[model samples]
Target chain A: MRILVTVKHVPDLQSQRSFTGGRVTRTADDGTMNELDEHAVEAALQLVEAAGEGEVYALTVGGADAVVAVRKALQLGVQHAIHVSDDAIADSDVFGTAKVMAAAVRKVQDEAPLDLVITGMAALDGLTSMLPTALAAELDWSQATLASAVSVAGGEVTVERHLADAHETVVAPLPAVVSVTDEANKPRYPNFKLIMAARKAPVALWSLADLGVDPASVGREGARTVVVDASPAPPRENRVTVTDTGDGGTQLADFLIEKGLA
Target chain B: MTTVAVLIDHRDGEVTRPALEALTLARSLGTPVAVWLGSVPSADAVALVGDYGATEVRVVDAEMRLAGHAAAALGAALEDADVVVVISTFVTKEIVTRLAMATGAGVVVDAAGAEIVDGRVETVQTVFAATWNVRTRIHTERAIVGIRPNTTQAVPADTPGDAVIVPVTVDRPATRERVVAVEPVERGAGVPLAEAPVVVSGGRGTGGDYALVTELAELLGGAVGASRDATDEGWISHEHMVGQTGTTVTPALYVAAGISGAVHHRGGMQASGTIVCINLDPDAPIFEISDFGVVGSLFDVIPQAIARIREHRAG
Candidate 1:
């Protein structure tokens, strides 16, 4: 089996995140692989290990900082890494990004026929949860998303999706795209040897030209959506702090009663 | 006037609250048209949609499992609408994204507010794990927007709606994914977390004992939630985790017990109407966003609070 896992570098959730000129002002200094994408890498690694005769490749699309995402995947036991970066790809919306990613996936498929592609349920930064479906549409491939568990056999892929009301078992043919939720598996930590090797490993860098994508068809120019305005969230006010004073529970109950909440 | 299409989400012929919220928002943009998929809207569901300001109801007869056919059904029903609104659920997000890609329309997800400004559809998005609120506009003439629940209350327009059954044929491809089975996850609970009006959440301070939290939730007819730390410690399942990475919830009242109020946890419950925090540390960050807070041990305070509430209810 030949599998490719996609990862993304996002601004750390704990950092102070903001936007400028309607674009996210990414704090690359604090950027890291999307926490959810780790599950995708772990799933791919596990699949390869289970097959005992397959290779796992990591792919990322973003600016230079995005290579950090690929490197992180490599450290998690992926054999090969590819980073697709170009100035023209900046500020691409989900649709533009999906187009570029689909093209890059096709380029990789040319080198090695892939049997499966895996991605996180959603990218932390965008949180759209739309990329898997959009990329599948662009690639004309079947997709099973938000899977809590995944298994591949007999030229088919089956997944158990944990939804709000029900746990669904979904299935698709081989060469399908699957997105795993964080509950799928626990990501393994990179050992010292793997960490050192990942630091030294070379990652192939591809641009829009390399992927046969038009510069005008990507980036801000190719974006289907535009941000008209952006501003800081208004500060929350009217917070009331109360001391325990040995009657905290009574006070809380009275407050709830007053508000008709209890 | 331009028409705004709102996808009506329903289960077993009951209109959902989020769908009503979406319809309310849709009315602000233009004439609200409620689009129902999978099943025909019952008379009461139609009347409810009308009460929520839907001027017309379009029903597309299809199975819920045929999700791939949804985009086409919606496209055919909403071909004339300038903007489309959908509730931000997992299935709707996929259908709306596919429709947007197919039509080359701009798509916005998790919008808290949407309106027509200067002849363009402008939307407010809570991004960066709800740390920043950015207002965006779609350049394209047609746009798709997914609105989160509880962004606004569903208001009645008091206008009866006209119903139409639109025939749609989905050119589904041969190699699409299929749902083989759906098993409902059972929880020891009063209500589903997403649909619960009140939620009581526990944290690391619970010390792997959710007994108190669960009891309070059940007493109040609410749902139980857990912080990531508690779930990570195996005190509860990840399904109960409320954080940026977990489920984003918006309840009428949210009670955080023994939680430190990490940004991640706040992202999930910040949209709730009334936030109450109980913790031993006065300096804990959870107190900042809380509308009401008490500096005390949850173990000591919760039992008393529960007893008081029970007594008050009985009287």
Candidate 2:
């Protein structure tokens, strides 16, 4: 019943997000754990608690500040945390990121068998929604993604996928990868005791060399995609403001009629 | 001419509009070859592909799963093609990623338009929650691109409809995820949010009462949408949320009632043709983008507007 949840450290969406030199300019000052990943951690913790004898570990890959994501997970009741950071891992595309994460998961498995790997539906920054499948391909495990609800029993994992058009139930065997949506659970706020403990917890740090990964196969050099050009969106203009002088609705209806939109 | 492979998504032998849009976009770059993943292509499906300017349709008789296997199937078949075009969906995103991994090609998702520039495939993406448009080129010999639906209108081209049955070896690893059941959600009756020509959205200003919003949407024959705040408060489902993280919509007319219009929510509906806003706050950000603004309470404004529209229609 041991589970590993993948978390990410991303720039807060409320901040002014921009790109520089054909790359996303992420400032560590405003970065925090991806909001969606909270559901993954919550789901894993619930599963472990329900089973009564298991552990939940949180894993993240980013720069030094990324350890904050793992620390956040520990505060949510996860037992162990691992952070894989290397200078060469910067600007790694989705494929390279998946490779590094898969390698790290394997390394973790060597110490203890992993029954499940969980992740959020998508990172707020990239919004790719491709990592869970890529990691499943790398680990050669079954994958169920975008699950709104999940339950594991009898060496099988079942999930309800809440797609735009329909709701579907999907099932995969044990040792599978699954990505949960924000509707999966409400993440509990860390208690004062756990919050203090998390600040003091030692986060295991691993390097690319430690994972036996070739530096040349990842990072900017290994990325397949390139941003040729970027530009800001044109500013919106030509707005007409109307004050409600008791006939505002009449004016609005007239405006819609004038535009042939009513 | 370079060969462009377009994945044709269909259901029960009917070609979806997004698939036709993909084919139309593919035809702009090079010779388009439609790759049908399901059962043998029916006559109507072949004709539809031809109308979208596909030179030839390649039918792959395989049960495609959302898992990475469908990408493997297409990747194996598209070895000779220069570019692969797929509709950007939850399933196709993963397929495109797998295709890139298998072929050592770069991949782009959510592209609004794509064309060959300087002998390289260039894709324009609406990034930063649709606040910016970034042009990118995959630095590879071959490229896989995921085009968002409604990015461009599907235009017909003169072509001789031809079909080819290609036997594909799907080199998919053992599937990790399997769909056991599919239940249709009960949405009652209304145009789908993505396909509707008009959308009426409410926000936190609704104060947990979507009655006015839904009524106005029904009167307008449009879809009902909600801001993230409303959805977060359990007033509506996340699917109906229109924002950066929710459904991006481009409709002819969008009515914002009680929405203060945060940047994230504005990103989803800014592409709409005409916008109308009704809010108590005159200084709401929504007023900046709206073509018509009514500074009043939605509870007071919506009912009057709806009644006037109905009366006008009856006349």
**Clashing residue pairs, backbone N/CA/C < 3 A, model 2:** A142-B176, A143-B176, A143-B177
A14-117, model 1: which lDDT tens digit per residue? 77777778777665698889989999999998888888889988999998888999999989889999999999999898888889999988998888889888
TM-score of 2: 0.90
Candidate 2, number of clashes: 3
lDDT of model 1, residue B187: 69
Interface alpha-carbon RMSD, every candidate: 2.1, 2.3
Q: Model 1 Cα displacement at A207 (Å)?
A: 0.9
RMSD in Å for all candidates: 2.4, 2.9
Quote the TM-score that chain A achieves in each candidate: 0.95, 0.94
lDDT of 2 by residue, A71-190 (tens): 999999899999999999998888889999999999999999899999998887777788998898778888888888989999999998877677889899989999998779889999
Error of 1 at B178 (Å): 2.0
- Over 4 Å off, model 2: A250-262, B63-65, B158-174, B187-191, B206-221, B229-238, B262-264, B270-274, B283-285, B288-291, B303-315
